[model samples]
Target: MLIWLFLAMNFIITEVVKGIKHLYNEEVAESLISIQDTRKEFEGQATIVVFPIVRFSKKSPEQTANDLGAYLVDNLKEVTAFNVVKGFLNLSIANDYWLDLFNNSLLQPDFGVIPSNGRKVMVEYSSPNTNKPLHLGHVRNNLLGYSVSELLKADGAEVYKVNLVNDRGIHICKSMLAWQKWGNGETPESSGLKGDHLVGKYYVIFDKEYKKEIEALKAEGQTEDEAKKNAPLIKAAQAMLLAWEAGDEAVIDLWKTMNGWVYEGFAISYKNLGVDFDKFYYESNTYLLGKDTVEEGLAKGVFFKKEDGSVWIDLTADGLDQKLVLRADGTSVYITQDLGTAQMKYDDFKMNESIYVVGNEQDYHFKVLFLILDKLGKSWAKGLYHLSYGMVDLPSGKMKSREGTVVDADDLIAEMVATAKQKTEALGKVDHFSEEERETLYYNIGMGALKYFLLKVEPKKRLLFDPAESIDFQGNTGPFIQYTHARIKSLLLKADYTPGVFIDNQVALSETELDMIILLAKYPSEISAAAKTFSPASLANYIYEVAKMFNKFYHEIPPIVKEEDEQLKRLRLSLSDVTAGILKSGMRILGIEVPERM
Candidate 1:
């Protein structure tokens, strides 16, 4: 895809080198002749940095630009005209060049994609705990992971999407104990609530009641810290955790039932969010996996046992404190399972890379994990990456799970769809549509708006998501891009667009039309940069520019269906088709759907 675009730059660079040699009697290297897209204010398609060639010319910057511009205009047919801005020499390509490119290159379906390189990658995300339903934070994590996987695939990699479920531990035990102490046995069927929501209700109830217990103890002349440790509810939850690990049939059965409920709820939310996993690893199953690994590390002297029989790795010399891999009572720490899981994933796929899409809070945790794996002489340690992102904040403020103020993923999605419906109907375009079409269109736009709003920013930056602001049709929002795509589709349908049509004769080009073509030419670059940086923000904003430019062209140029010149009309219609194709392609990488109709 980039080959065609680079050919133009290559031609300009080759000619600039020749121009320097001819004028200065100096043979300049092609690398020394730098070229880029000309500034919008300049009346050209490409620019050359004449400052670098100044040493050869032995002239002022302006004089250098003027000298090279004159040579290119006279010698190269592709170079129709030239303009000089200080040391920058901007060269205009002939109309025939853009016309040929639009006809032959831009209209291809996969114009911006990288061909498969057969490299394998795994992205793990949405590792939600089974104690509660997923919230807005999980929403961001899932979207970032899914789109990153898509971008990697677009960059010619074979990507695997996976999830790790934290279905066991003290947190899960809290919800179980809360439910057990409550009056009656309530199920999803009985409560008419989603399974995860039901479990989450108990989790919150546990916190509410646990707080009361702590307050009561503190009121009894106890320090606040001491009261927290002596809280009866917390002690019971701890006991439940031990009983769970002991494989007591009654406790184990209850744990399985609650976790099962949460999983079912997660599946529903994931489906609504348009995200999925290729495989799922549960902590309950993987928690003990690292003991063997710990044993191996001990044998290799990479790990040492403390006086109380705890397995630890001293990393103080490596600039980190000693990290525990196993407890004194033969229990695994969080890092222990992570080490085993890393090795297990490598063994399973032998993939070239692994990316864990976690939040920024775990930054140090991953740093330690990767260092330990590397210290263990693992071959794939260097390929591990932690795709850390900032937390999402609502207009209200930060979310808290125990207080039950977090934005539920399922609820937020439904609210977005509702907002989309209200905003979309005000346009009054759905009157002629059926119920099902309206619903589908609403889902696409709502989900598109949500995903775009979250993914448009770099993952490292925390963002305040406003659903109302994201569904606008006149700004850099998802609906705006979707509406542009639908408009282009409408224009093409009206013009009765013909495929494989080329403009043979030279025709007048509007400034807006020229700008549209130039922006269209940048589609491949947008994809490549986004893939290289693993940033959908770059691609998302690039698509916005394409849509914005096409809108300008649409309003500024004469209507295509009404134009009398057959060749000109064909060119305009072809431009519209390619613009829509590129918009759809870019949006797909961001996991957004562009509708054919508004």
Candidate 2:
């Protein structure tokens, strides 16, 4: 619509330049046109800057603005009036235009969703290892990835959500070896522990024992590195990795059993997190995938072999150090697996874009991976993106998985829900609800608060998760927004809102009312900007502002149910209805559920 107005203004200005001014230079006329949103102090809807055209008119900025403003007012029905401020020609849109925009938006079921643009995008997130239960870090990863995928979908791109499980490697072997050596047939069912937690316990146990052995070896006069390498437990875990790689049935069976437990645990956590993936890729299946790709790269001379038979890619030319693609023993390294996975993903979806939602620690890793693929002449490599996000910390400081100090995702979620229940009960807001309804509401608010708190921050910045701060009902928090939605819903219900009632054009709108209409009109553009930047923070903050504006309007404007005039009541009710719709729509994109009753 803004573009349409710009085109309309351009045509009118071009005509004015050719006929009224007798200056037919197309370049001068084109350069003179600039349309933008009116400044807050300006009494208009849109502003046309006339400073650029003053030279063409050989007139003062104010006079040139006045001339252009007169032409626009006479030509465009939407431009009912205009004012000149210095060089800015501020045009006031007629009240009917705002009403029509509201009505058009109300008629459309999916107001902010863009039409399909025929592009496929693959977003890989929640790349959790099978060694342990997901922690707060994984929570951030999943939320960011899921929200990004939804943003892309809202932008009309075909998106595929994927997860890559690190089910192989020495990390998995640590847990398996620990269980084999220490366990007397303990399982999740027997221990009454979550599967991932149960497996994680063994991993921690392995670390503790490995440290003890290393200390003992050091006490026996060996150097630190020698002690670490000679530690019996570490060596056993290393052997287990080799055995599993060699397809040893016993090692493979143990690996599957333990990984199965972790998978089951992960499934529950993902469900609780309200995140899902269309597919899952396993390192066990993909570890050898890149070996063939390496051979191909070597054949193409994209990678060179050293005397020790190790294949390397000299990315120094690309401003990165030379990276090892394959070891001297002909074993595939991390980059090898990544190369194979990239090709496999491309082969699977042929996505126009493939986004890896990884921690910033792996920024260099992705740079090398993408460069290697690009050097291999893969066309889709250019579309690969590393959505590197900063780590999530707690007020308690950093977490260490080996030390068993990380805040587990399941536990954090449970705590959040509990916190919600406590906060809601303290406020005495759920006195009339049943236990089931209360539980559902608590879940929605808890998860909503959790997700919104994480997503409101820019992805590249490290965040401190403060549970109490996030669940507040009176600030820039999720519950505050959720409460506003509930408030609007309650107001609408009390008024018995009836759809399709036309607001009278003669009706006067208060400043707050007009401001809200303008804000509501910006929703589609906000979503587009959010999608384009791959940042939910934009939409999150926009919705917060909308909620804030609505709250102010609720306090300042006349009560909708008590408005004396029928037209006024209908208009106020329409405003409330549209505000609620946009609030719900925006929160949905952030993977939040706005409850009908808080």
Candidate 3:
């Protein structure tokens, strides 16, 4: 989202700088001039801090503000009146300015959206492993990555959304091996289970049986770590990984079949969750990518090979320990695949920035990855970022995929929709909706509840998600903002509002009405801030505030739809119209949908 600021704030700041130059014969940077919303106790729509300008004025603070106030009201038509309080200058903007914004803002389809700024970026998110279905942890990851991409687009950056599926390695081989050993052929159709869930079931089975082997070995007097290393199941899974990589036909066929099932399962889960990817890079295809690069790094002395033949990079002087890039057995590690994948993505898109939306668990991993790339003299390494977010905790506690205790993404989506159905029916508004309409409404409300709840929090914070608490129709929840959008739509429908209708400047205004226009003006800035921080929570909270303000304006005035004066009624209707536009545009980028009714 782009926060191309409104005219008044920019205009005021520019004029204030000019005023300072003329009055004090001084040079001032525009950034030093602070313009903000007026305090409730003050008598203006906007407030300017006079203290920053005091050094330019030879007079006392109050006197300096008074002189500036006189200059502004006399010279600028937008400044209708002004008052001085201590060192602050409160300027009441003329109604013409407010009325013009309400009138013209609706003319453009993309009201607060900024045009393209020619910056190309790639956001990698929802990078799931084929060994298991996505879980609550994946939920937060997907929502954050998708929304951040949308936010960057709104800020006028050309963005590509990509996903990296961990389809190879020992983890996947474990699931494949367990399925083969335990099952007499259990396909997704045969078991009536989602493909990913079916595979995930075998993964848990592998862990359970693997644990038994470890415990039995431990009982034979070996240490715990020694038992783990000697476990037969682990060795078999490792062998399977080697075979699959070596292109053994039987292992390769099984890998393809199982990975296919998981992909089918992942598609349904992603659609239900309202997230997607433009391109997918599998670890299997890119696992060998960084080998040549490693050789190049070795020749350049960026990498060192120890006596055992493992390639490594020394970074202790850079405040980090040495990191291994390749094993002595000539196999790539996890970071090796990442190093190659990063290079391939850059080679494909050549984006200005490549943001990795992974959990904080990989913070050190990315720091090393980017630093290694930089040491290898890749120019794009400078633009690499790790958008590290904290984990999402449930009331039950942290989830474990190997224990089969994680909440499946598909199941959670169904539960949210079901919860939405129950709450919406209890609320009694959806009784008139059709079966299909009711289902669609339920999904929108439910997913809106889920996405908004996850996106509204600062991405770096570990959030405890309460599904029931998030579905409420009031408070700062998703349903509240969704409902507010519906309310504005209902109001616009009743008033028969037409876009681009002229709003008279002479109409009498209430503080709440003007307060809404002022609040609406902040939408552009909100987008800019959200994009800069790579945090959807900033935009999420701003929309909630706008919704709250709209509701206050709605309830405070009785029958705005049927006021005695035509001009006042039209202005209110237009205000409602613009509010609805802002709410819809804001929520859309967060991967949420707001219904026109209910």
Best by lDDT: 3
lDDT of 1 by residue, 465-511 (tens): 76556555458889889999999998889888876666664876777
Write one digit per residue (lDDT tens) for candidate 3, span 10-72. Answer: 888888888888888888998887778888888988888889778888789999899889889
What residue pairs clash in candidate 3, if any at all? 1-151, 1-154, 1-155, 3-524
The best-first sequence of candidates by lDDT reads 3, 1, 2
In model 1, state the lDDT of residue 188. Answer: 91
- Candidate 1, lDDT over the whole model: 0.87
Worst 10 residues of 2 by lDDT: 1-10
TM-scores for candidates 1 onward, in order: 0.95, 0.94, 0.96
Best TM-score among the predictions, by candidate number: 3
Clashes of each: 0, 0, 4
Tell me the RMSD of model 3 versus the true structure: 2.0
Please identify model 3 stretches exceeding 4 Å from their true place: 1-7, 402-404
